[model samples]
Target: MRSLKKSLVHMLSVPLLLSLSCHSFADLTIDGKPAPHQNLSTHDVKELLADDDELELTPQGSTTASTTLRQSNGAPPAMHSGVVDTTFMNNAGPNVHAGSALVMDAQTGEVLFSKNSNSSRPMASITKLMTAVVTADAHLDMSQDITLEPIDFDGPKKASTKLRAGDKMNRAEVLLVALMKSENPAAAALARTYPGGKPAFIAAMNAKARELGMSSTHYFESTGLDPRNVSSARDLAILVTQAYKYGVIRQFSSTPHYDFNLGYRMLNASNTNALVRNGGWNINLSKTGFINEAGRCVVMHTTVNSRPAVVVLMGEPTTQARNTDATDLLNWLTGLPKDT
Candidate 1:
């Protein structure tokens, strides 16, 4: 949220994102109708959670699921599906909390549990998931050298990378750092590097969303700081489903820290997601995001109930709420019979 300055030191051109910026936003549509502004029922949410497809942070900012977990102390509940148990999911412990959430089966793309999964909400930096993915797919030689131009600083929000005009970094190092640390400048730079500038990159992002079957999602910016970058939990699950499959994305997103040298300075990047430290959750793909508009958001891929799954929570009023929502769902997942 700093003032936008002129002169982008980075020499990259972003044709894609610039195009996206020009088009006026259309109201979201899903399943051939206007997107449901409200959340889905818990029952409908539960159905979506059982699917094996889960959110992948574009496999960027993505290390989808580390795997393996233990049983919860509670008795297993009867599941609604051939896979996970709905009754167990319905029975929430006192700690379960969030404004919106959905637990998804990573492999089958089923919903095992949900609260307000259909509502479109601001996503904050989780939009980086798509940013990371597009970078990987663009075939940019990540090892290629580039400088952070001042033009890269004009994102919807502040540039947290502390990059001033003329700072230099490689593609791979910046990509890894930006996704993990949630750097605004790096995201803008990544977008600007694409064809058609930032607008074209954003267009490509929405196009990619369409290709992946994300029925209710759109990206106006790469850093996710833009309030206009929004999606529902249901649509986000589809985003993660395609995101978790990338090897590089998976490695970088799950990493707790990365050290890179910018000339004489050593840049240390870390993730905001506390689940990385939970010890209980075998996190595969995870990203944490927040802004006043979005509250707090987290999307994770993990093995709960001994099966791969995705969990998406958005608009939790507090950081604690985000953690609570994810943890409670994990508890529900662990309590369900593995075969239920």
Candidate 2:
């Protein structure tokens, strides 16, 4: 009986000793050295824990890098090194509902306003801006005719188009409709007719992005239907700045309306961006886009209070919200000094 009692005591003491040892060393670091917990006050410990939660730490307790002040669509912000205007966070700028946005001096490349500007997200038909850029770069015969094919109708969205498979239009007219109407088929036709076809055109789009220092941008196709065609607002600001150097993109994108002569009839289409037709605003370049994933997005290079600024808004829930943001931004810009 004493022998059995001694065995029970041994077992119980072993567990007690093991528990005490674990409790004693719980404050040790991975290297078996004592942690700096002795120097940490209760408030300091609380602050450290709070910071950990804010950083979106991994399972291994390492923090992920983020430039966005708020999360959008549960997407982590892509790494970017663009200049940011930290003052925008303190109500020093306009209030906007867009998930990501930026405003920059078109000529100086100075950022004036920024909100989640580095979060890469789907850009919708805004992809056509790059399409327009690539077409202009090739200097292809703008007068050459391109016949729409059945494959032109294919896209991730399978969007409807007025142009039929057999319809034909000169390259310039095709570009006009694509930029002004956000016509997916028109863009696809341009890609299909490129020197080496769609593959080459897509490559050119990505290459152009790289050349422009758009590290956070990527393109899988000319049309923005693919959610994979992503860019941050800051990168898009750079795109708009570069695109402004092209007269065709500026003219076609800003044109309020265009009438395409298809031999048999006139197809009238208006610019997708309403601000261009507003008359009160001086819009030099404009493009609007929408998709279930991208929400309502808009990019504009316009003069506000005699200051040329490029505005990029992404992931707005509604058109009204997007437009309201734009108008608010314009008003905010107008209130600033001219030199700003």
Overall lDDT per candidate, in order of appearance: 0.61, 0.69
Q: What tens digits encode model 2's per-residue C-alpha lDDT throughout 165-243?
A: 8777767668878987889999999999999999999999999999877888899998899998898898888787766
What lDDT would candidate 1 get against the real structure? 0.61
- How far does residue 297 in candidate 1 sit from its true spot (Å)? 0.2
Top model number, lDDT: 2
Q: Please report how far candidate 2 places residue 48 from its true position, in Å.
A: 59
**Model 1: per-residue lDDT, tens digit, 1-108?**
011101010101100010012121122221123322322233322222222134233221233432211123332222211222122243453344555677766654
* Candidate 2: worst-modelled 10 consecutive residues by lDDT: 16-25
Candidate 2 at 124: error in angstroms? 0.8
Clashing pairs in 2: none
lDDT of 2 at 238: 75
**What's the residue-level lDDT of 259 in candidate 1?**
48
Per-residue lDDT, model 1, residue 102, is: 72
Mark the regions of model 1 whose C-alpha exceeds 4 Å error after superposition.
1-95
